[model samples]
Target: MTSVSQRPAPTPRQLTRTSDRLSFIYLERCTVHREANAITAQDAEGTTHIPSATIGTLLLGPGTRVTHQAMSVLGETGAAVCWVGEHGVRYYASGRALSRSSALMEAQARQWANPRQRLAVARDMYRMRFPDEDPTSLTRQELLGREGRRVKDCYRAQAARTGVPWRGRRYSPGDFTAGDTVNQSITAAAQCMYGIAHAVVTSLACSPALGFVHSGHELSFVLDIADLYKTEIGIPLAFDIAAESDEDPGPRTRRALRDRINEISLLNRCVDDIKRLLIPEATARAAAETDRDVVTLQTDGGHHIASGINYDDHENATW
Candidate 1:
């Protein structure tokens, strides 16, 4: 008999056989159709039709709409659907197919329970996109440390530039007391971080519910990662944006803010580095696990799999 450890690792076929299933559909001003047993999509007023054989998840923006035929096709495909509302809120549809549900759930659970594993997976993902960075020496703790310092410094600089009082108080890992001006800054900073984290989670094809370091609650693990960036990135950016313009931020200000974020060299570099370090670690952790239980499969199959994996509803913190 083959020893469990000596057995050939699960091939894609085996992984899929035991995997929870899911797919995503992103609708950013695009229309979808089913033709010749394939899904075809086109942008509004655009001629190019993108075709997909299977869809595990569906993502939509506020203005996105689905025709009856499109819904029928998706249901037939047995894909889970996720959408972002006009307010940037997120929602998900239950998967109709067992295969899709198993795959998605497994991926999501792994995402939530282990930050190190998540970071490892993120690292691999970034490496695939940017091969120049060496991943062996990089770690999540290092990234978080660098980011934490940057956030503090950025906040201070922005406060000075904007003439906003920098409260001497250092923010701890908890909710801010009400009626404090410093609290306002903290809240703004947190919100910006949350947005970025949400973007990262969405891009990574992982469910935000499955978090690593953070306790599972209303705020996502992605949100927690985003929170980590608030002081370093969000606070300073918010201050700079508020200082540069005399008028309240409208559409133009929002666009400027986004552009500013994109142009941030240090922040972008850190994010890329962190992704490189995290993705592979997470993937490896998932690969090492032997458990086949769906719940364990979800929780134990990613990097940082051994620690900080709890789902407590009371862990919610407001900033």
Candidate 2:
């Protein structure tokens, strides 16, 4: 076995890309420790090895204990670690991004900082969700109205297709068991989607609070990203799981959704979609600079200068 000190931290290129990683892995009643480049989960059964670099997010459910070395390896591999409730019902905390660059975050901020641009991105998101409909001329109220109607339609359509009974969405906060089978599954699926989105958002080094459609919350951007797949993936899958059986809908939906997400390569598409929404005009350039570590100092008139250089001088400089 290789000693811990002998293993060098993996570089950005050496680590698995977020788009190619597992959406999120939930572990409970296990002790997580590091062994070389992989994490070992020790439970009553035995020890299972998981490649740390391939994890987009690690959700530590109840009764999960993690060692410092495990965290170190996870951090080096740029995996987001989230402390979540059972079956990821409640989210408590998250780890850092995999990226060293802030270009995407800058692009997101630039689009969000302007009212017209923000509205345009919001409209674009609406368009992505409903490609057949045009939302370019709709006001925020109209967009919200349309979104509500469309989601309701999706619920009804999925119910009809699955032959499941639907009485609208009835979710009682803090009580997962309060809702019917479909509702419980929907909530579970949504939570899992949130986990996946949060991992992607953080991995891309984008601010989770800056959002085009949703606002005023730390995870507003996460919610916005997750909703992009609700009607298409989460809702339909939830209804399908509910149709199959009502037993343990939360865990069942999570497992099924994980499989579905991987099947559709949702992470890759999600990364591309977010880039298109926030920085459509600069996707190529953004992709090229995603892994760069260069930093620059801001100058007047939208200019950037080298960070290590001293700008103060007796001679007049235009900088």
Candidate 3:
């Protein structure tokens, strides 16, 4: 048997793609450890082995304990690990991304650095959420107003459809039970969406804090991406779950949302949407196709030269 240190780490191309993996696997009250490349979850009933490479995100809910070997395999396999609260309502921490390339990260930074470009991206985000409406000329205030109205309308519509009593949205952080069954479902779904979106964003190596629309928060970009599907997916599904039964709405919503995510191939769509929003279509395609682990030296006038060769004799060389 090979030692852990002697095991070869899989390259980016060797690992499973974010778009083709399991949406998420939520576990609680289990002791997670590793056996070869598979992570085993042991509980009172029995132990179950999960292929580490095929998992998009591992949501460790309350009472779940993970060993270092499990985490090592998960990181090696490029599977995101998220420590979430009960019913996956709160997100505490996350693991590294799968991507080895910085193409998308650079594009996000370039678009976020300029005020005009940032606003343009914000408008584009709004357009994505509401494809039928045009937002090219809307200011930030107007955009916020429109978003608020649309969300309110969605709530009313879902309520009407589900026949769940409609009251104003009420939610307080750290208090999952503060709201009614519908609101709890919505909150649960939103948190799950955040976890999923966060996994995809990080898998693509995009900065979660550098959001075009949301600002100041560490998960601003994650929030922005998750909101893109709220009205269409999260809200409606939350209502459906609540309408079914209020018992364990949080867990119920999470399971239902996972099914919906898989049914719609949401992970694939999210990866494509993120790339489209940050980079040109041609560049996005090129970046996705590039599997090289390359390094370069940046010189004056935005030029990049091949790395590893010293230019000590040249006076014009900056490095």
Off by over 4 Å in 3: 281-285, 289-291, 313-319
Please, what are the lDDT tens digits per residue for candidate 2 over residues 1-319? 8767567876777778899999989899999999877999999999999999999889999999999899988998999999998667899998879988898999999999999999999999999999999998999999999999999999999989999999989988778899999999999999999999999999989999999999999999999999999999999999999999989999999899989999999999999988888778765665778777788888789888888866666247785
Q: After superposition, how far is residue 128 of candidate 1 from its true place, in Å?
A: 20
- Candidate 3 clash pair list: none
Give residue 103's lDDT in candidate 2 (0 to 100): 86
Clashes of each: 51, 0, 0
User: Candidate 3's residue-wise lDDT over 19-63, tens digit each?
Assistant: 999999999999999998999999999999999998999999889
Pick the TM-score winner.
Answer: 3
Tell me the spans in candidate 2 whose CA falls farther than 4 Å from its real position: 1-8, 310-315
Ranking by lDDT: 2, 3, 1
State how far residue 89 of model 3 sits from its true place (Å): 2.0
State every prediction's TM-score relative to the real structure. Answer: 0.40, 0.95, 0.96
Compose the digit string of candidate 1's lDDT tens values, residues 1-319: 6532353432223332111222223455666665543456666576443333244345555566566555655544334445554322333333233132233345556554576666765445334433555554567676455545645666677777778667654443333333244433445445334544443443333465655445556445555556545544555655665555534422223344445555663334433433433333445444333222333212333422323456465245221
Q: Could you tell me the lDDT of residue 297 within candidate 3?
A: 79
Report the error of model 3 at residue 124, Å. 0.8
Candidate 2: worst 10 consecutive residues by lDDT?
310-319
